[model samples]
Target: MTGATVRPVAIKLDDAMKARLKRLAEARQRTPHWLMREAITDYVEREEKREAFRQDALKAWEAYRSSGLHLSAAEADAWLEQLEQGHDIDPPPCHS
Candidate 1:
């Protein structure tokens, strides 16, 4: 490959696990190294996805804190019931 870097590293695994990996690799016509690389890549991608979701949750929390929307549990329920009954209820005026 052009300008691609490759490195060799040793890993330790149990005999049975290594045997299974070898069998699966042969069945898929791939080398153990290739399968291990693919597995690591998949793991990295999954972790990145989890991190992104966490970041999104944090952003949502920040927006919620800044949106000036506040309601107690009873007030929220009352508001929901009002909407269910087709009654027009206005939100409290924003102090700021």
Candidate 2:
């Protein structure tokens, strides 16, 4: 962030919320601005990761629909079990 340009954005909060933020900021020995920035950053990062996972699932589903290739639940469970048992293993091949 050292070289990045930043702009100020204002948000309106109710009196109770503003007081709470101020108290929390004082307890944490931080500015209310810092707390707000951290909260927004964390939320954005979590949402981005969630979106990426959703996209991956959608892509996998599309691929499976096109190729009709997939593993049964039992097959996937067995592979997962082997990995959980400390065995280095590859996933089983997909089949129609």
Candidate 3:
């Protein structure tokens, strides 16, 4: 076992918790280990997606700031109306 990966991990749970895990594993038609691994994988994927969205939002804000562009209230309303009318307005140069 010299070159093999052998690591011991310990988890502490009460009888009720063990029973719940067993039931969950059975319901999912998986072993307890598979259930735990899948749950962890899903949680990490969700967190990554959220972080990516947050980063994209930040980039949009940064581009808006650096462009030093501001539209009047009427102009903004017209722009939105154009969008609502299905006009294919391009994104800002920086965003593009």
Candidate 4:
């Protein structure tokens, strides 16, 4: 592997949890260290996406409040219903 700096992380796991991790690692044919690394990577990626989405939602809300530009619930529901039914439709327009 290229010289990628790796930091050591330690976690305190009770006996049962440690046993479970070991069993899962063996079942997956991976080392406990590899499993922990993968689990942490997946968790961080998922949480980062969630945080970004939350920030975008907050910004959209603030913009709507300041400019009063938005689609009514009925309009949004219609667009969403069409999309759910697999119809190709343009998004509803936002207006004051």
Higher-TM-score candidate of 1 and 2? 2
TM-score of each: 0.63, 0.96, 0.59, 0.86
Q: Looking at model 4, which ten-residue stretch has the lowest summed lDDT?
A: 1-10
Per-residue lDDT tens digits for candidate 4, residues 39-80, read: 988999999999999999999999999999999889999999
- Residues 1-96 of candidate 2: C-alpha lDDT, one tens digit per residue: 798899999999999999999999999999999999999999999999999999999999999999999999999999999999999999999999
Query: Candidate 1, residues 37-89: lDDT per residue as tens digits?
Result: 89988999999999999999988678668995556667778777898999898
Count: clashes, candidate 4:
0
lDDT of 1: 0.84
lDDT to native, each model:
0.84, 0.99, 0.79, 0.94
Runs off by more than 4 Å, candidate 1: 1-4, 69-96
* Model 4 accuracy (lDDT, Cα): 0.94
Query: Alpha-carbon error at 26 in model 2, in Å?
Result: 0.8
Off by over 4 Å in 3: 1-15, 69-96
Among all candidates shown, the one with the greatest TM-score = 2
Provide the clashing-pair count of each candidate structure. 0, 0, 0, 0
Off by over 4 Å in 4: 1-3, 85-87
Best by lDDT: 2
> Model 2 scores what on Cα lDDT?
0.99
Q: Arrange candidates by TM-score, highest first: which order?
A: 2, 4, 1, 3
